[model samples]
Target: MNLGARHPGTEAAWATGEYIRHELERAGCRVWTQEFSYRGVRLRNVVGVLGEGKGPISLLGAHYDTRRLADRDVSYPTRPVPGANDGDSGVAVLLELARALDQERLANEVWLAFFDAEDQGGIDGWPWSVGASYMAANLPA
Candidate 1:
């Protein structure tokens, strides 16, 4: 609840990324971030990993980007969602899972993917999942 609306390319978003990274590390997960730029906006994807099994990976994902404009709000269509509950709730769940599962002696690797630029759709001049698209296009070997 303390984290504010994490709009893409905003201070809140970056701070949230830092928070997720720190939390992942605190949970004993190997953590890293992927930085990408799309249409002049730079965004990040935070990833946390556990386990050493070298087979297929299991992924848990959540979008962390909040819509910059609450177009559906009757009173303040232009204002951002106060808490971005839809986005942040998933983050909270993943964080809790990361904390809970970090101690398990598992056989399969688990990855927690926090994606950005997911709530940008329908906003003028913005597209959805730009950060995720960039990550998928530039996946690591």
Candidate 2:
């Protein structure tokens, strides 16, 4: 997947989304991509469904986009973070959970969502959760 920064509307961001989708699909979940726009930037959200039922849906979510600025590091303040834990850890958990759900039996429906452009706030021209808000407003099935 994208090892560099996954800023909004960037190629890296798109790659990141695809990686999540691939992993989810490999884990036996049916996946779909939701596309939306924010501040003239096109963003995508990946949704994966595990098992089938008509009850309350359980949602697992994580932001896959890396922050544009490494404001925490004084030496590399403007550089991008690898996001190994900040972004990858959450995604990794969901992916592994998806795999587990494949073997285990659950009553309710489970949804694995990878939200993009979430860590873009306070820098560049983007805001926090712009992509996520769009996804929430749309709230697809």
Q: Candidate 2's residue-wise lDDT over 25-130, tens digit each? A: 8888889888987778788989898875736888889988888799778899988877889888998999999888753467788888899888878786667887
Residue 55, candidate 2: C-alpha displacement in angstroms: 1.6
TM-score of 2: 0.89
In model 2, the clashing pairs are none
lDDT of 2 at 56: 80
Model 1 agreement with the true structure over 1-141: per-residue lDDT tens digits: 476788888888888899999998898889878997767777899998888464578888898888888899999999987654688889899999888884467767888889988888878778777777776787667
